[model samples]
Target chain A: MRWINVLPGVLVTFALLLPAPAAAKTELYSALGEEAGISRLMETFLLEIAADERIVEHFIDTDIERLHRLLTEQICELVGGPCVYSGEDMVTVHTGMGISHAEFNALVENLMTAMDAEGIPVGAQNQLLALLAEMHPEVVKL
Target chain B: MHTNKFVGVALAGLALAVVQPVYADQGRFIATGAATTIDGAGGGGIVPWATLSSYAEEGQWGATASLTEVNVDDFALSVSAASLTFDNRFEFSIARQRFDLSTIGGELEQDIIGVKTRLYGDLIYGDLPQISAGIQYKKNRRFDLPSAVGAVDDSGLDYYVSAAKAWLDGPFHRTWLANVTLRATRANQTGLLGFGGDQNDDYKLMTEAAVGMFINRHWAVGMEYKQKPNNLSFADEQHWRDYFVAYFPTKSVALVAAYADLGSIAGLDAQEGIYVSLQATF
Candidate 1:
């Protein structure tokens, strides 16, 4: 192949990399409805998780109410809400849990469903997911 | 020969559809399969995307079937394809294309066998873009017309590498994805005129790209562009482009519509018209 013929292709690719139209600031706190919305989201999310057969076994022995509180606080803080996360670090909590990527993905799916039910926009939901995805290494020990 | 090839591919597709077991635990979110490309790969209407075909999970099986139609001003192209993906890592596909030459008074057909593999990266999880490499083997069914027009060979191959990235909620407050591909091909008029013409027998590097913004979880609007090589001196081959909308009412079905410009083909100018495609995944 002639290397010169590839010049146009290279140029076009760089052009596509330029900035696109602007979007609104993705403030996680605003997207998740701050404190009240986070609380409701956690409630709905827990219900969905409890109903799911795949990951429900993990929560069987755990305290439901405490789990809700910790989740609300963790999500709130992660998304820039005023609430502080008082839950234990992810590694300490999930170390012996032997969580797999499939189980984690399932839980995330349930979370997405709960957010959808609460009328959270897809973009905001993805924003929240992006933040949570960072904890995959710590949460999926197995 | 062409009929036999088509039958073989169709039978293979049907067999995979029947044998493959569908699973709910497949990774990658819903509606992320994009649309089936004309070449039977997972992508937009015209261009192959970095996304894998729908279905399949780690250590599991998945399959897809699609029909696509492209109507230009003077001609029409229809494609039927089936693909099977393994473990969300490797994909094998076969597609048959029929070119109805309304103005030229004869039809041309071709069969394509393709394979694609996810090399590395993730569309959403990692900072790096998801990358994939693919190849397509193409054979034209009719050789008389192409041979008379100075085609050197009836069969050819295309090799490509693609990179894709998806932004969930970055600067754009909406979900968006972008993909870029570089292909080396000797196909003329995308193999309608056969491969390796008298003017250019060597494969040329070309570019293809797609960018999409999700209006919602089920609907997205996007554009795709694919550059072509002008191997046949009989006519000028220009870049292909389209503006499209894709909708997924459910995970198993996707519909895509586009207005596309295929440029000039066999001296016919302004081959701009409508394109529509339907895909079913399992």
Candidate 2:
């Protein structure tokens, strides 16, 4: 086992290097082009959700206009932008939705597509994804 | 005798058997699942990771079919594999491994059935890394070569526990994945040359690891190392390693290319090769 000891070292490194998303929040917020950019991104993301049949059913009865505003504000606050989120909490909003993991993932992919369309850098996109992925437990109770 | 058809039909049947009970879809994110290993486990080419196969998230069934080829200096190996993942937690896999001895002019074959279950945590989320426990049951169809080479058994079982983690913003701010696995086994040359031997008949604990980063949503590159036990005295087996590039064009299809250094095979040294695999996820 000449190289047997290498993996533990690498695993420890990966563990220790888990980035602090808070450290780069404002910079990331700026990278997402601030509130206007986020608003544009939200528009694109909602359009994607509207088009995708897998997840569209979840939002059919909701208010798209208010949902758009709330998403924009939520993302703005999450990225450390100036705007504050005024929407209901994730669990509260999603409590009775019965959202499955597949639907959650589908929406995440749509958001990724939206970010790509917005021309967000991969690094910035990942940063945002890390923040949003945290809501998975809250959104999909199962 | 017909390894391809056998594995394909068996795997597909297993998947369809479970289809009526669960909704199947590409639920997980792209490249989140590990590639199918030669041993028919979900992981890198040689080492199994904690991540399950395919894009099956919770409450979904994800099925896949894969074909892999390894052309080495002394041997050419082909593996036909398929797996079904359910509820993002359990994986059932089957594979047919054919090891062709290019120099010896004979071939060795085996069929493997594996089951893996997620024990705790999420691969990309929270404080703990994703952890899983699995077992592979391997039965060698052609045992003559193994028997002649001091192998003691025609079949064996391997049990393993693995932990894996991913950082969305890692080195270079790209998504990175790392995994470590510990396996207990007595299989010789991953069971193609049989199980147990004159040198060691008891199961030994072996460590395997894999690490890689997704350069983007569509492409990833990584490397793996698998430690093997020296069960047979006739040929001193060395560990195996490989560096691989994986491409996931969509959630439904994946392709992997790798350069493997198998170290030694039945007294043959420096057995290196090119490994290519194609996988389809449903």
Model 2 off-target regions past 4 Å?
A1-23, B1-24
Q: After best superposition, candidate 1 residue B221: deviation in angstroms? A: 1.0
Q: What lDDT tens digits, residue by residue, belong to model 2 across residues B1-282?
A: 334644553464445434432333778888887688998888889998999998888877888888888878989888999999998899999999999898988999999999999999989778578999999999999899999999999999999999998888776768888888999999999999899999999999998888888998888998888889999989889888888999876666677888999998999998997887777777
Candidate number achieving the greatest DockQ relative to the actual structure: 2
Q: What TM-score quantifies how close candidate 1 is to the native fold?
A: 0.87
lDDT of 1 by residue, B102-179 (tens): 888999999999999989987666667889999999999998888888889999999999898876654455677888
Alpha-carbon interface RMSD for all candidates, in angstroms: 4.8, 2.4
Q: Model 2: per-residue lDDT, tens digit, A61-100? A: 9999999999999999998888889988998999988888
* Best candidate, TM-score: 2
Model 1's chain B yields a TM-score of 0.90
Which residue pairs come into collision in candidate 1?
A: none
In the order shown, what is each candidate's alpha-carbon RMSD? 5.9, 4.9
